[model samples]
Target: MAAKAHLQEQIRQLPHRPGVYKYFDDEGIIYVGKAVDLRKRVSSYFTKQDHNKKTQQLVKNIKRIEFTIVDNESDAFLLENNLIKQHQPKYNILLKDGKTYPYLCLTNERFPRLIPTRKKINDGSRYYGPYANLTAMNVVLELIRALYPLRTCTYNLTPENVAAGKFKVCLEYHLGNCKGPCEALQEEETYNQYIQQIRSILNGNLTIPKAYFRERMMAAAQEQQYELAHTLKKKLDRLDDFQAKSTVVNASLSNIDVFSIASNEKSSFINYLKVMNGSVILTQSLEVQKKLDEMDEEILPPLIMQMREEFESDSKEILTNVALPSLPLPGVTVSTPQIGDKRKLLELSIKNVLYLRKEKESMNDRSKDLNEVRIMETIKKDLRLTELPKHIECFDNSNFQGDNPVAAMVCFRNAKPSKKDYRHYHIKTVIGPNDFDSMYEVVTRRYRRLVDEGASLPQLVIVDGGKGQLSMAVKALKDLNLWGQIPVIGIAKRLEEIYVPNDPLPLYIDKKSESLRLFQRMRDEVHRFGITFHRNRRDAATLKTELTEVKGLGPATADKLLSKFKSVKKIRELSEAELVAEIGKAKARVLLSYFEQQEQAAE
Candidate 1:
């Protein structure tokens, strides 16, 4: 109670200005927050009753508070983001498990060297990307190497060393893959021109280099230099192909940065698109783990600033799906468009973020499926089967007092139900409610057709009965010469005991084991399927019997009525005039009178 009073007093003393605040526990800083008005925001934490679970926990853990006043909300926002990144406070959404991405660095030297590095140095060098991934970075490196014969050796290509002829041409020079700049065989001006063109290509601005190549190709063709013209044409075609693969949005919507966010309960996915001259020069999606219940406005601005700084975007206008608070950064306008080409661009950004979310979900689903496959493999090994039971079929019989007895077979492939392969059977060759006989008839008919048509057979077959049904199914398989070819098991309903064909006693699988659970699921599914089929058949039979008892309703008339109305209740509900349109007036009158007499008897 004393601590609560002290915290409330501290909140009361807070200044009503923009600032960043820190919440600390015994260990260290646990959370960082920003607010436009420090007094109101800080007081609400201790006063509000409807806080989310995470926020409530955070409030309980906080033992002390510290704050820094800023000039405005934007300054507070920047300070808050920096502190979160540096301290990575416990109750902040973090981009976990990622190192700084790799970028193609061009060194600041008289002759620049292009190489991949993970660090961004402040020396007077240029960086093209933090590329989408390592593979993309490598591809760009290979493309640059092919386009220009640049030197790869890390030699100090000082003018003094080159003029003194201290270096010898290496194998790369002889193979015509390098211009031998270290030996002074390549002039500085010409090499710098090639470097400039490579830089433009890396930046996704291909117009200048592309036009230069096209003009050279045309000039060479006019001079009748067919080979040189063909070579230039090939290079131009490669440039065109690369541009064609890039996503291009509206041509006039140039020099803008786009960001969109999609979030679920646990994490937020943010996709960033860099547009230069209306083309998407770069795209990246990042996932951040949420530690507290933060709103989109709270999470997005910090991330947007981080991405902009990482990509070195200097666009005057930024586009997003949600409106952003005024940022402290000068000369920048952040707008959420409602119509026109900018809105379309915002829609495109949203589409990319959604795609990234789906891709991550799909990857997680595939991992789960692989785990399921492994579980199925273990079941196969434990059962000591000849082959992995990738395809399994289970059968169950259902009947009610010897009426409409039916059997159903449910198929499971890779431990999941395969509904299309499920089959239903009426007790064609069995009599009464004899489950063993029903099992035998269904098994024989199922495998007989499969054998006749040369269809694929299930690796395992299960019967939902004890030893009696198991013995009958075994006899049917033996009669069909398939007893040893396919493995079969039976499960009892009461104790969940499994019965194999040649085993004297039942095999008791552990109740909690995955294999036993799978067997139980298959048993329950087949039981449900069989019961549904049996009920449907019984209802149709009862409807037919009731229809035939009416006067002037023979077998043909009953069949016609059943086909037209689907049920006797539907026929009962139809008016006499509506029935006359289908049949004649005489029959319609008889049907109406029959229904009236039945209702009066019930009353």
Candidate 2:
């Protein structure tokens, strides 16, 4: 109680200005938070009643509070993010998959080398992209190499070394891939011109190179250098292709950063797009786990600052989907446009974040499917089956008092239902709800058709009964010469026991095992499907009988009424005019009188 009052008193004394705050427990810093007003934000924790369990626990454990007043909200945001990155506070949200993405580095040297790196150094070098993946980075590097004859050797390329003629040109120079800068065969000024064009291309500005190549191609053609002109044309074509693929936005909107966020109950997804000279130079999507229920206004600003620092974005203008509070940063404009190209760019960023969210969901679903496949393979090995049950079909018989007996077969492919492949059968050549005989007929009919039609077969077949049903299915398979070719088993409903042919002892799978759960799912699905089909058939039969009993209603009339109205009750409820339109007036009157008499009789 004393601690609570003291914390509240400290909160009341807090300055009403932008700052970062740290919550301390006995062990260490439990959480770090930032706010525009130190007093209002810090006081809310002790005053508010509706915090999430994690936040509530954090507040409970707070033994001391510390804060540092910043100049404004932007500084506080940057400071808070830096502190969180450094300390990784227990209660603060953190990026789960935070690792530096790869960048294409152009080294700062007389003969600079183009290489892919994961680290960014500050030694006067130019880096492009923290590219989304290595393949993209490699594509850019390949394009650069094909267009320009840059030196691949790591020679000093110092004026003194070249003057003394101390180095020799390598095989790259002989192959016409390098300009032989090591042997002073290429002028530094000419090489740097190529470097400048390459840099422009990497920055999503291809006009410089395209124009230069166009001029060179025309000059070579005028000089009657046909081969050289063709080479230049090919380079131009490559540049055009690269540019066409790279640019996705309006060329007039240049030097802007796009940030958009999408959040759910558990995590937030933020996507960043760096547009330079109207081309997207960099793109990244990051997911941060939500440790507390923080609003987007609170979550996005800090993330924007952090991403700006991480990507080293210096764009003065940032576009978002919503208006942001003014930041303390000098000369930065954050705007949410309602129309025009900027709005379109904002929409694009939102689209990217949504796509990334969907992609992550799809990836998680695929991972789950892979795990299920592994489980099924384990089941196959454990059961000593001939093949993995990539496709499985389960059969169950349904009947109520030997009326409208039917069977259903549910198909499972890759551990999920294939509804299109499911089959339903009306009992033929079997009667009185004999489970074994019904199983025999269904299995024989299913496989015989597959064999005759040359259709693919399931690796495993399941019968939803015990040993008797198993034996019957085995006989049917043997009749079709498929007994030993396909594995068949039966599951008993009472004990959930599995029975195999010619095996007296039943296989009792562990109740908690995924294999058993899979079998249970198959059994339940077949049962449900069989029951639904049986019910539909039974209802149709009942309707037909009831219609036949209606006086003055012929079989043809009954069929037409059932085809139109679908049921006797529905036909009875139709207006006299509607009924007359379907049948004749005389039949319509008769139908109305019959229903009236029935209602009166019920009363």
Candidate 3:
């Protein structure tokens, strides 16, 4: 109690500004976080009753609360990343994969050999790609071999060694695989030109080599050397094929870094693509496991910083799926591209992450835990819920031009739909296209009635809209005192940003995750259900006046046909045979003649 009082006092003294905060126990700093408002954020630890288990435990151990005020949220995030990494906090996400990837090292020598190596030493060697795809790297190596006849030997090609006749040309030279720089059979300048061209290609500038080949082919043709021109044209074709294979966007993309992230219950998978001239020169994927339930927004900055450091990337422009306020890099432009070449690159990076996520999931499926229980566990972890969401319900609102406003709730148990528990709600209190108020009213009515009837509430609640609808739902939950008893999430339709109640940043579950698929399935089910109900209600309101007036057709038959077909417009589009199947031949002919008379009158 004394420690709690002390921390509350400290939190009260905190400035209401954006910054990073640290929690310290008797030993040292154990956890770190950032917020746009330090006082409100830190105070939530004591005030909120719905802290997750990890957070509750963290709050219990915090003997001291320390914070640094920054100018904005971006700086706070950057500082939090640096502090956690420097202190190695116990309750921070840990980057786990430490395996060294292979890089194509071009040795800084008289004869630079393009070779694949995992170990990097600061010996003036230019390394390209810690390639995520080894086959792609091998293809590049083969292309380089076909383009240049560089030596593969490790013999010292020093000028003194060659001048002293210390080395001799071997079978490689005879096989046209080497220009034999060891014996001074190839000049250093010519060998360096070959290395330079290879270096350009490695850096994803096929323009250099392509232009070289094109110019040579043109010169050969101009000199009337048709056979030589044909040979050069073949090389040009090979270069074009290689370029087409490597490039992910238009040929103008250069010096832009791309990063995308996907996460499941425990780990975040990040894919990084270093683009040069529309080609991905370096592709790498990393996994970071969560210990403190950090969000994608919190995970990405450090991941980007760590990756940029590991690869020594100096690209001025970075494209990502998540939006960052600012980066530690100076003079860098970071954007989340919605459309254009950069968007395609970002999408390709996301595809890479999705593939990695699927591969990891496949490996996990080999274990025995990938059943119904595992799905609930995954939902619990991925959504950061305190308990398993075994019985989940999702809500969606539907309206046609602010008419016949209706909402639906679809229930799922054990990761499958429960049609018996499905509900459709008509808008009663609110009118117009106000989804926010409609959601609040529906949630209040549903849960309050359940409470009054002493019925059990669902383990999880999901709303289909962005922050506005989510906030309304949360308000309803709080008003009913069900906030701490149940967990609710909202899924935005377009971007799929999962909004939680207190957290400002949204969570992005992996696109391929079963948990996310469950949410989507529930969402889609509600949309379908809600729209169907809304249309029926609207038609019913119309039929009370319009269906009774159809001449020679009794109200019973018109109501039956309209209710079955749902609308008169749809009934008109039906074939006579189909209409006969519903209302019989004589009625079908009368309805068709009525429609024909209406069309003739209009004409």
Candidate 4:
């Protein structure tokens, strides 16, 4: 029989409920999928019109179809994600290029110390970051060593085991980054406090450390320890270098993800950035389209979701490899909040995107277009920004009926992703697809940190949509007492129109202008960021929701099964005995009965 005929024949056996489906090519390579309505979703492949080139090609390669019915779409989605990760089917675009992201580790010893490593070291000490870039991570490490002057010796320096002649402080002490703790030149109590300060700063809680430093400086001055006070002053000056990079202000937010999307004639790029505490931790870039092939839905939102899944998986790997610091205060849970420092971080991500776009435009033309330079100059003047928004920031929101509402901020420094700075925000405030509320949450979370610190701000802020989002962001700035001082604009989707704050009709800068390209890129990146966050949240929610409907399953058991097996097909492959061995016999039996009933219903 023809491939379509075989698929249609198989579809006739499928249940009209949530389930996972698999397609096998002649070589028996399997591609896995999940659908809310397996019967309807699979049947569309055989009967639906307007199949894209990728789908048609997929259809042609299929030699057989297989499916397992589930109780709901949530199960199907979870099963599908797991299956895709396990089988790595060619059809599902897999994210996370396969290696775990790196994180800084500090061993849990009586004498805790910091070091750079990828694997999780849960010995006892604090872990600082799954930092987005190695430079940023290393810079913090260097700063900690310089400012704290703690030991970095590899020899066993434990109190019970320290040998008189076994070890001494390395050359680091001579260079002034260490306090020579190896030789007991530095007291254990004092060094311990310095280590605490380093960990605190890396976790994005600096207020306590700042205060501690001030108190110590004052105490030294009162004691007439002129040299010690001056040294403390120098250390305080060094702390400013940390501030020179990014100023993250405190907000009541936790664990928020931000995203932004941008596109040109050839391809669209979505940037996903996540902030934990006040730190910008990770950034991801997703290709929205490849060649002429594209997804059926409009590109912005779906692609963003795809990136979020990739980034989230990466995040898990990071967390496992790096131990989290203990919360500074009780009742302060970890949350990806929607306001304060989080919002500013999101805006910085957008500027990174715009900067890249502008760089591309400038290089595309052999000659420096004077008009382009003028536009750039005008942007600098209008924004009162120090640099030619040679770096720009933008924001956008994506959601489906409030379920997976998300916001993204992409950076365009010199018109490229700054891939280092792009961020995604999982919307925390608005539900039910309220774009304005979502954007407001994102802006406030991202920027409140910077505003609180009184740090220099991004050159410009752009929104992916039109006046409404721009006004929403503007209102946030104004409320924070940051209105006219910073430039905010919007990019309308249909005509590639630009809307600056207070400007009514859309403004179209020259297509060839670098400044225009920069703004477009920023807008696109934020859209991509927002969409990716929404999709991942939606798919995750769907999976969680549906899995709950299954008998004899709780969230813990479901999460374990999904994490262990990663797919329904794999779960199906396991015998009841194997399942019972992993979970309990009772739960295993319940699962078996559930699958059996679902299969029977499909039949």
Top model by TM-score, which number?
1
Tens-place lDDT digits, model 4, residues 28-145: 6456776778888877777766777777888778888888888876566566666766787776655444235556777776567688876665566555556656777787788777
Residue 255 lDDT in model 3? 87
Displacement of the residue 181 alpha carbon in candidate 1, Å? 3.1
Q: So what's the TM-score on candidate 4?
A: 0.51
| Weakest lDDT window of 10 consecutive positions for candidate 1 | 93-102
lDDT of 1 by residue, 1-603 (tens): 123776777777889998999999999999999999998888888778888898889999988889999998888988998898889899987643335778998888867888899888899999888776788788788877877788878888899988888888899999988888888889999889988998888877888889888999999999999999998899898888877887788778778999898887777789888888778877888877778767777778888888888777888888888777887779989999999988888888899889888888888789978977886886787678878888999999999999998999999998899999999998998889899999999999999999999999889999999999999999989999998888899999999999998798998777887888899999999999999999989988898888788878777878888888899889888887889887779988888888989899999
- For candidate 4, the 10 contiguous residues with the lowest summed lDDT are 316-325
The whole-model C-alpha lDDT of candidate 3 against the native structure comes to: 0.85
- Which parts of model 3 have CA positions greater than 4 angstroms off? 1-3, 9-19, 25-28, 35-37, 66-75, 96-99, 133-136, 217-234, 355-366, 369-603
Candidate 4 Cα lDDT to native: 0.67
Give the alpha carbon lDDT tens digit for every residue of 193-248 in model 2. Answer: 99999898788789999999999999999999999999999999999898888857
lDDT of 2 at 169: 90
Better of 2 and 3 by lDDT: 2
Q: Report lDDT (CA) for all predictions.
A: 0.86, 0.87, 0.85, 0.67
**Per-residue error at 570 for model 2, in Å?**
43
How should the candidates be ordered by lDDT, best one leading? Answer: 2, 1, 3, 4
